[model samples]
Target: MDTASGLTYAVLGTGALGGYYGACLQKAGLEVHYLLRSDFDLVQRQGLVIESPDGDFALPQVNAYRRSPDMPRCDVVIVALKTTQNHLLPDLLPPVVKDDGVVLVLQNGLGVEAEAAAIAGPERVLGGLCFLCSNKVGPGRIRHLDYKKISMGEYSAAGEAVGITDRMRRIAADFERADIPIELAEDLVLARWKKLMWNIPFNGLSVVLNATTQDMMANPDARSLAEALMEEVMKGAAAQGRAIAPEFVQTMLDHTAKMKPYRTSMKIDYDEKRPLEVEAMYGNPLRAAQAVGARLPQIQTLYQQLRFLDAQNRGL
Candidate 1:
């Protein structure tokens, strides 16, 4: 990895998460190649547009490719695609990752890093949980509503602490230089669960009621329900030997209370008639909890509802 000039990055998704992060890296003078499908022509012709609360910029000349074979193998391949598209990684990753490169899984939901690791190898895989509210509103255009911090972790099959590596620090420096705040997580499993504490409740309830975070928090019943669901996520994490402090739940609620009202990634995906990532986000968490005798009645109900709604949305 080139710390001075930043690693050559290939963004695999080119959607809200990918586009925002990649654009930030590009603007900071890093070499970024975006692997785009539907937005290829639009971005290749007009470049990518970012509308952020921090600031806004337009890239007039971006390296855009429609196929992996046409892309250069990069030092870091950021797989920011939705977990719903995990099925495509075995085919999409190899061409984008150099033999000595790293593959960063900047995605939501549980069990995502493992799936990415399968394609990029465990040692080569790193997991990133993006604490952001961003969405792609148009082809080549992304709307970054609020929050840009990311908790990044090393992927270890044993699910134990792997102290910060040179690679991890290098990537951290790269993000910090790009003005993006990052927390280096020594234990990836705990980090994933910490992220899920906020993810499971908000993402699920947002879709169930067709409401935003603020909307849910505004209604007393919905607010109570959201908090209850969050408790389940905490317990589920503990069941897997990842103990999250109960105080963090209040911290999460307070943080969200101050955040700008925004639609969750899952809600956005559902509204667009895309396949919802029910399995990774809900089903996997439920299974983990069940394995440890932790019952999540509220989450189980939400999971079933999302499954039904997701199947209908995807025409499954």
Candidate 2:
């Protein structure tokens, strides 16, 4: 479909990431439907309240639904659910997405786009790597701490480069209209691996060591360990034909250093006793590396630790 004419969006997961972005789009005068779980009634009754560094805003009225089948079939579906809950997508996607609509996964970790592709079809799937620091503080309320940009690209079944297409450009336009910066990536796989350079270190260490971003960056030993994990992620990427630059490691370190003292999503999940996305964030990447004869011992150790922690926390 020609989204330039005006695209309607369905936000499948209305939490920190999804709620913030969907509210932004709706506030910008675009049609957006949000699918909520526990807070569906609260959002529908009170609407969404966003507290951001940019500014504070509230949507007095929102298009909120408790289920996908209740929402109108939309031109674009944004999947912002944590990978731990992605099993719901197979049943949640088809009902609310138009026949020709696309699914844009605003998620972290590796192989997520492929999972979405399996549900929505390869050509209809797009990957978006979000660099947002936001949290759902309460029902229908989000606190946006810092950084809101997305790198997006079309998905390829072969994991090859798919340059920017009109579909991507059209989607970028809508996000840009809502004041979100969008970088068009030529290779989705490379972009995902690049994201892991930061996610692998900070997200994993945050849970295992019970530290925040500032805590890890402040201590010399923790900082060194984080960098080593990043190097392993770089190696994993290279093994998969995505050669990340050596300097990119330092770039991620610098970025995290300047970021606010915040707990990563995985750490927050662990703290809340919610299921951590151990498999998606760590397991899949490790397996991908091992498949290509690349050994990431440090990352493997971290992955195992996280798995243990997740099982113990959730009582599995």
Give the candidate number with the greatest lDDT: 2
TM-score of each: 0.95, 0.97
Q: lDDT tens string, model 2, 137-230?
A: 9999999998899999989998899898999998899998898999999999999999999889989999999999999999999999999999
The worst-scoring run of ten residues by lDDT in candidate 2 lies at: 1-10
| Model 2 alpha-carbon drift over 4 Å, by segment | 1-5
Tell me the lDDT of model 2 at 182: 98
lDDT of every model, 2 decimals: 0.88, 0.92
Off by over 4 Å in 1: 1-6
Which candidate number has the best TM-score? 2
Estimate candidate 2's alpha-carbon lDDT, on a 0 to 1 scale.
0.92
Q: Which residue pairs clash in candidate 2? A: none
